[model samples]
Each structure stands twice: as structure tokens, then as C-alpha cells.
Target: MSGATSTGDVLTINGTGLFVDDRGPKDAPTLLFVHGGPGQGSYDFMHAQGDRLAERLRVVGVDQRGVLRSDPLPSGAPLNVQVLLEDFEALRQALDVDSWTILGHSAGGGYAIRYAHQHPASVRAAIYDCPCWDSDGTDRYRLPIAADLLERYGELEAARRCRELAAKPERLDPDDQSWGAMRALGKRYNELFFHQPDNTDALDRIGSQSGLTEDQWRRGVSHLPLLTEMYESKQHLLPELSQPSLLVHGRHDLVVPPDDVQAFRDSVPNGRVHTFERSGHFAYIEEPDEYAAVVTDFVVSAHR
Candidate 1:
């Protein structure tokens, strides 16, 4: 820890050091970010919107356990949903905060929702940013959208393959269809994830300056193939999050299709959906000021 309110720190907890970028006033309503990617560190998030959200909320973004910035999972150690939530609880106690709002982006949304379900008393509200609640659902649904995008980009053959893959009930990752299509797109593959390619460049710039070593950045890969069939079955156990929830989506986000976003909103008892018409998966980077404003407004009201 650097200071009383250090924006960057790697604190040792449970015999493991986890990276955290904690900012904003200690007295402010805290908002903890549970990143997606299962392994994608919070570095990009902290770099993108940490300062902006910190201006109004005590924004806390941590690379999930065994993810970037955090120590790798030890041999014979486990990385189940329960243990991941436990680590957040540990961080809460370490920070001395009673409760805080949580924002989960992409795959992180799964983790955030589980955290809220497991520790409701410690969570004030939930925010889902282009969340992937069901990996299989998203992987399959995104295929048709990817097909459409590929077709628009003039990769006719690849687009056809995407459509074929979308028809199947088992396409669970990029390797299924989008990967082949994206591979065809060559460098332009990144375009499928962004509304504006220029904004993709901006996000890339932030990541470029992330200062995380390549090895640390890639450590979370170990989590991708873990046997979480047990927890994966129960991930949707809390279909209706009781907390005041906000679901944000980019109209152009192919990965988490519009139907899923709509379904998420309908499932929430007290939920609101905000769409960034001009963004893709990363609205915070594509439209930072607006994203921060929307999130800040919802978070402040929810905190009260």
C-alpha cells in the first residue's frame, strides 16, 4: 500500500498478494469492480474509468484471484466461485468498508452476480456491463451477430460459416465460429468487438500503458479450462437479483447480443437498462464521460 488512499496496491491476503487500484475518498460510497475474462486484470478498467468513477464513488477494481496482478493459483489450490467470492470478502474486511456497490463487466458479470447472491448484506447494488451471464448462451447467440458483422465487412465465406455455427446448440467459444471468421478478418478481427475501430485503438492504448508484465497479464489463462461444471450449473441460481440493478449495453456489442441484455433487464425486479448507441463492448472507453455519468448517477442513488 502506498498511502492512506493509495490508488495502486498489492496487498497480501490469505497468503496471496492481490492487485487493487483503489481510488476516491474513503467516505464516498464505494463501488467495487469485478472484471470479466475470469482472468483479465482490472488494469484496463482502473486505467479507463477508475479516475472518473473515483471522482464520485470510492472505486475499487481488483484483478480477480489468480488473475492479472494477483498471485497465480498454487498447485492443488482451487478456483471455484465460492473461493472467488471469499477473496472479495477478504478485501472488504481489509479495506474496512462495510458494503459497496459492484460493477461486473462481461464474464465478470457472472462473478459479480454470484458475489451479490452469496453476500447480499455486503453488496448495495449490482451493475452488469455487457455481462456474459451464460457462457454457452452468449457464445451461441453471438455467432449470428458475428455472421452479420462478417458479412457486412465483405467476408462472405466466413459470414456463411458463422451462420452455420450459430444454428448449432453447442458453439461455446470463439474457436467455434467467430474465431474462424475473425481469423479471416485478420487484424480487423478486433472490429467485431468495437462500434468504432478508433475507440478500439484508444482501449488498446490504455492497455499498452497498463505496465503489467506479459507473464502477469497472461496468468489468468489458467482459469479458462478449469473444471467449474459444478458451479457453472449453479451460476444462474439467482436469476432475479433482488438488489437495485443497472444493465448497460452497447448496441453494437456482438459478444453479448441484444436479446440477452433485454432478458437480463426483464429478470431484474428493480432494474434499468442503458444502451450506448455508439459503443460496442467497452463503452467506458468508447464513451467515457457518458458512461461515467450514467454509472455515477445510478450508483449514487442506489447507494442511498
Candidate 2:
């Protein structure tokens, strides 16, 4: 693990009510990291990765609308996908970088793909680390990951409910207690999928980023129910991205799965895939050396 050396500024995207953590050097080629969570920001997790990535390239980490340090919570806005994509374009202009690359993980992957599709000219290259490609696609793709959940909890009823929710996308009532339990179980399952040594801390931070207290977080768990909807709708926009791309996924990734990775490889006109052998969903953390190498190699190859 590398010790974090910090030098960054927090700025707002004008009129959009969102914030971004700009790291690394101004002169360095900008590599913007679009975090997942239509609402979750890229503060801690992005910073953890940025601490390493910034050393090689300027890492721009953004907290999407509604997440930490960003304004206009999804609760306060219309919470549609188009609004978010526009916010991203606005962000790039506000930052004033002529051309840049973007890397997205998990939900961020979905965002990254959409952004690249709409703004291909501005992107130097794009990387999708287990992007949630389509809403229906994710349902099929996540079955195995969900199996890991059922295996851990052995709650047939809960598993059935989860499967139903994932199968049929819908906005859950954020105030429902059962929905909170469902979300907590999902988070636990995601950690198990990653198999990281210190998953508890990362999971805790992720759970905390909702800008809500423990009770509120659990109580409002269904607020992000749209995740399933957004994820399933992930694929149709793939053809729009013409930028050179890399899709890094763990063969054993229980969350996004290798099958989904393969689908991406086949869909993108200019895309490549790097499979991590023993790692799971969070390959960057599980296989840090390999993850860094893959990203560095792709970035270097593109620049050449």
C-alpha cells in the first residue's frame, strides 16, 4: 500500500450544484475519475486510488450530484440519468481541460460509458472497470453475485425479494425498513465479492457516504433503488463511444462477472479487455500491482 501525499482542491460545478476533488498536477494529462452512485461522491474511495494514480497522471475525482460534498441530492432533484450525463459535460468545460481520459468503477462504470458516448471528441481514452452495462444485463450478470449473498445469509425469503427487485426495476420507497435491510445485505455481499483484506473499513466508508447517519442511511436505503434500473439500462449506449477503451475485470468477479466483461469487449468498436486471474470485483484493491500495470499500459499505449 502507498502512503497518501495530498495536494488537491475542491471546486463546485457552477449551476449544477455538484463538487469535484481535483488532484495531481495541472500540467499533467488529466485523467478524470467519474465515481458511481448517481448520488454517491468519489471522496474517500477515489482518494485512496487517486493517491496512487495521481503520481503518474493528474487524477481528477468527482463527487457526482447528491453524494458527499456535492449539492442537490437526488432527493432534491428529478433523479434522471440524462441530467447526470449533462452535469459531466458541464464539469469538463468548467475544468478547462482540452482532452482527457476517464476511468469508472462499478456504478461509476455506467456513468463513464454514458459520458464517453456523449462526449467522445473530448475523451482521449476511456476505461470501464466492471461497468454496469444494462439494467436487464445486470440482472442476468449479477445472479451469481446474488447467489453469493444468499449463500452467506441463507435467507431464502430475503434472497427471493432481492431477486425480484433486481429482476423488475422499480423505485423503492426510501423510508422502508425492509429496503434498508436489503441494501445492507447487498453491501455486505459486495464486500464478500471483492474478498479484500480490509473490506469492512471500505464498506463502512461506502455506507457512510450517503450523507446520512446510520439510522437514516439504513432507513433511506431504498433511495438508490434506481441503481438497478440504471444498471440494467447500461448497454444500449455502448455504440456511441468511439474512444479507445479498456475494460478490466476479474474473472472471478462475483459482482459484475466475467461474462459481462466479455460482452463489453464484443460491443465496443475500439475496446480491449484485461482479465485478472484470482481477483474478484474490486480488482484494483485485490490485485493492485496488476491493476496499476493494466491502466498504465493502456494509457501509455494510447498516448503513443
On TM-score, the candidate that comes out on top is 1
User: Which 10-residue window in model 2 sums to the lowest lDDT?
Assistant: 1-10
Candidate closest to the true structure, highest lDDT: 1
lDDT of 2 by residue, 1-304 (tens): 1112243344555454555666667777678787654454566545356666766777787666655545445444565556667777777887888778888877778878877887878888999886766544554455535645775777676667656655555533323233333454654655545655575356466555545354433322322755644644666666667889988877766446556666676788898888888767677667777777677667756655
Per-residue lDDT tens digits for candidate 1, residues 132-179, read 766556656666766776787798988888677667765355345345
Kindly provide the TM-score of model 2 when superposed on the true structure, using C-alpha atoms: 0.78
Q: Give the clash count for model 2.
A: 11
What is the alpha-carbon lDDT for the whole of candidate 2?
0.64
- Please list the residue runs of candidate 1 whose C-alpha ends up more than 4 Å from where it truly belongs after superposition: 1-7, 148-161, 170-184, 226-239
